[model samples]
Target: MRKIAIAVSLSIFIAFLIATAFLIHPFGYPPSEMDDYIIENTQSETGANNAVTAVVFDYRGFDTLGEATILFTAVTGVVMLFRAKKKREK
Candidate 1:
């Protein structure tokens, strides 16, 4: 019974994957609306001359900030741990 259930689940998942593969857009043709919009409006929207800078610091500002915060926290934790161990050894 358990084997039959697992087989049925796998077959259903395989059918779903095949169906999805057919429904997706063909290879080499990407959806370009977002990229087009960004390129066209980067200067006007953010007045930034660099598109890469605009995307990183403007469009993804909060995400970048969160990453920076996590990185800073990790470094601080490591430094604190090392400093404490050094002090204990002395």
Candidate 2:
């Protein structure tokens, strides 16, 4: 019964992932209006010479902040784990 339940849950999760994956756009073909708008207005709106910088710092500032936070958290977690392991060994 436990094996059957685990199998059913795994199957359902995989099916859900496949359904969402199919809805995603094909690679390198994202021809959207937002791309044109960003290219045209990046210098004027954000005053950043580089479009990538403009997008990261101006448009997606909060997103970049969140990503930085996550990276810091992961590094801290790894350091803590290593420290604990070293203490145990000693």
Candidate 3:
């Protein structure tokens, strides 16, 4: 019974993944409106020579900061989990 249930669940998950893969847009297409707007304005608006840097540091500053915070927390949690606990000898 357990094996049957596992097989059914795995089959459903795989089907969903296949359906999603087919729904995605094809590659090498023209940029979306938002992307075009960002590329056009990045240099003049942000005063950055590199558009990628301008987008990361100026346009998406808060979003990038949140990502950094999340990454730092994850690393700290992993480090704490693996750190050796000192034994107190009586």
Candidate 4:
């Protein structure tokens, strides 16, 4: 009985996930109005092959720094949690 209930719940969850994915259009890649001019000027002025990388790293470096700090903190927490504790002498 428990197995049947779990199977039914999992099937319903999977169906809901599939339905949601079909309803949402995840691949919409339309360019925004604000980026058009900046991108063109960046490529022309800076001669950067990838405008997106240039904008992300050069224009918004502070935001990237915050993201890196968050990643570092998470890694530190994981290391601390998994570190071997020294055995106490009797």
Model 4 per-residue lDDT at 15:
100
Q: List candidate 2 stretches off by more than 4 Å.
A: 1-29
Compared with the true structure, what per-residue lDDT tens digits does model 1 show for residues 1-90? 999999999999999999999989987797999988999999999999999999999988998999999999999999999999999998
- Report clash pairs, candidate 3: none
Best by lDDT: 1
Model 3 alpha-carbon drift over 4 Å, by segment = 78-84, 87-90
Every candidate's lDDT = 0.95, 0.92, 0.85, 0.80
In the range 1-90, model 2's lDDT, one tens digit per residue, is: 999999999999999999888877886777689978999999889888899989888888999999999999999999999999999998
lDDT of 3 by residue, 3-89 (tens): 999999999999999998777776677458987988888877888878888888888899999999999999998877666443332
The clash count for each model shown is 0, 0, 0, 0
Model 4, which residues run further than 4 Å from truth? 1-31, 84-90
- In order of TM-score, best first, we have 3, 2, 1, 4
TM-score of each: 0.64, 0.65, 0.72, 0.53
Greater-lDDT candidate between 1 and 4: 1
Give RMSD to native, each candidate: 4.8, 3.4, 2.7, 4.4
Candidate 4 residue pairs in clash (backbone atoms < 3 Å): none
